[model samples]
Target: MSAARPAGPVGGVTGCVFPPATEARLAPARRIADAVLFEGYVLYPYRASAAKNRLRWQFGVLVPPGYGRDSGEHSHQRTECLLEPRGPGGHLAVELRFLRARRRTVQRAAAPGPDAYLTVPELELSDRVLTPWDEGVPESVRLLLPLERLTRPEGVEHPFLLPARRETEPVTEKGAPVGRLRYATEEVSGVLRLRARELPGPYGALRLTAVVANTGGWTAPPAGADRADALPHSLLSAHLLLALDRGRFLSATDPPRWAAPAVAECAGEHTWPVLADPEGGDDVLLSSPIILEDHPRIAPESPAALYDATEIDEILALRTACLTDREMREARGTDARAGAVVDFAASLPPEVLERLHGAVRSLREVSPVPGAADASGEQPWWDPGADRGVDPARDTVAVGGVAVGAGSRVLLRPGRRRTDAQDLFLDGRTALVEAVLHDVDGSVHLAVTVEDDPGADLWRAQGRFRYFQPDEVTPLEAS
Candidate 1:
């Protein structure tokens, strides 16, 4: 049976994870789980080729065994997600939904001579295709493709002269055919139903695993099997649908605003923990505190605190600043949906128009330098202008609550462990500030070289000089 849809307003985080093109392994699965919980799971201005997009597949990933292997019997793939319900003891249920690719073997009859008409006597042609899901889970869960007749180049539609046959079987031998199909069957699609069950506990953690296997035995053709070139295995989409008991739970897409203070103070910017099993199992724990309604210290504005009260004003301002008259007119062309979005963006308060322009101007100022530009292009406007010969002794500023300037020594703050290897590792280490630079965002940063290194040269043009934000360093006092 189809699972019931989630009722009432619901809030939760949803994101895409990388699918394993080959066999799903434990290391990659763990990494995927960690990535999904990482901050900035998906960045603004989402594009596939964006720099941020390189960090794709932060969610859980699963792949059938024997995938990407030269020769091996394929086995089922499994994925698990761990969840924690808020508040005291109560029952909880969740619905999982994901996209699975449908596999079908397409065949076309060879061309017959101009004078010849293709005809065949009544004969049975049976073949089995792979079936990925278990039995008793009603078939035809979704119609990704409707059943239709196959057409030839001559525009002749071949009719199914006899009833088609289908059955599910196991893959007892390597490279065995699974789903049975006849000459009349051109293509087919597969469907999956939501699997739900009661959690062991409401307040405690629960693990959910989705297992996919090619239970049917289907052997690919010896040759010319374009569809079978790659193993015909099902895939799961990253979108997950979660349902919580009504009136007993509170959910939000983003962390609450009160979380901001903690986030800022965090040595590393990670706001969520990797939900992996401590015993090296497939399941992982999702580690974010769930706010409860009746908590003694819970504030009424907690729910709305993270949201900007003037979001519409800011968005309207942004629209006016970014879109030209021609572009605005073009946005309304033909497509009613596009026009509606543009109209809504344009309908902002008049009082915020000036502020909107200012915001846009600031955004442009901090935009990244073009690829063709040299290092000088990154220089901020606040740097010394035409009078480039300013006295160094006269320039002094406070960074991270400490006085600093050229020749000043500072200590780097410890940062959390990072997988990207980009984390500044000079934590607690002292360095000499060779220069202080300001960026367009009105933030000060220090360029420093290691104090003890013999080759500590900042002028080599390609030396290991590092820049740190004001908050990431503190001025070292004189001995």
Candidate 2:
């Protein structure tokens, strides 16, 4: 189900209090904006080898100019925003920081003279040659002078450069022999800085734009560049740090429902966004977020009194159905963690177990005519009612602990044990029960549409529906 966007600040904060609609809220909004700032932020199942990973680098792609010409457009390397300040008479300061690789160029002399070899007399010395002597020596003479005596009298004396050979080319007995000297080597380091200026406002919002580029001349050129003009390129990771002061930041982004608890906590640290462009691209470079902790495991059962036993069983059953035989084998062959998952999937009832296995095998087959299999005096392959001996007539029908049937409005109970992905987003939420399907086993499942879910149509053109066991919901009494 799609989550309702929260109107106010979304992140939990520590330290100072934030003004209404200010920096506190601004942080989270920025995070949400950053989520799309880079391409391929996340993939389904989120495994490294998942098929969706092939589509990585789908967002925040900053392609070098002319690189993506095949697509008729170049990627944008900059993003800007106009942020409203929470209060009047305050200044705003922003610092945009991102990862930059170190690049340097070395310059060597075009012509180097023969290396000069100098020898020193027996004395400690700090440098090979001592310059600015009280008296200059004739180039014709070789001298071994005391370095310490020249600098300070009475210290441990050291011998300075004693020119061993003065190679001279006599010219007509009139010109002094000329000696060539070597030039010193030099290196230049690359640099990148975020630039912005203070703009005066009549106590309102201010504009902030961040530009990322290859400022250094030594960067490698983008792909498909002409060889003559091939320039160096500099790539940056997506993880950026934007420091702001003076104005209270308000909304930035809302937390994603699919984020694990650990990811959510890191996002709450006032960090803008989490993952970005896990699959790398030369045109679109991104910085990965630092994940300091792992996600907490959802418990198999909860001891809280409000926890629903029937809902737990149903969740376990559905989860088991989702597992493939290959996954079961892998789990069994792997460690305890995999074994636990295998154990859970193995706990489904016999009829449901067979249905799961059949579904896996028939994923590519066309569906048979509705009730055709049943008409043949055989149970439907996908029937959820097969082998159920209980009768619904003798069982009580309930929603949220209240006896309910069609047209009954009930508030979803909060704090239900979330043992499955389907249950996680529904907890503490409300839904309307459009219908109730009773199985031959006397178990009732509510067909509900969450008030907040933004429905979508797949290739089959069927609307997504959410179901819940009666015990998972509680009755909302009249006030």
Q: Which 10-residue span in candidate 2 carries the lowest summed lDDT?
A: 132-141
What would you estimate as the lDDT of candidate 1?
A: 0.33
Please give, for residues 1-479, the per-residue lDDT of candidate 1 as tens digits.
00111211122222223223211322333223222222132222222123543333222222233332333432333333333434433232222222222222222222433322223221112222121211101011111111110011222111111112333222222453322212211121222222222234333433333333333223344653322232223223222222222112111222235333332332311122332233333222222211111111212112111111112334433543366554444333212223333454466445534443332223343335332333555544544542354433345567656678778888877445421234355667888877767655766666778788677864435644677765777778632
Clashes of each: 22, 32
How high is the CA lDDT of each candidate model?
Answer: 0.33, 0.33
TM-score of 2: 0.26
Candidate 1 displacement at residue 269 in angstroms = 26
Where is model 2 more than 4 Å wrong at Cα? 1-42, 45-50, 66-75, 83-201, 214-241, 249-479
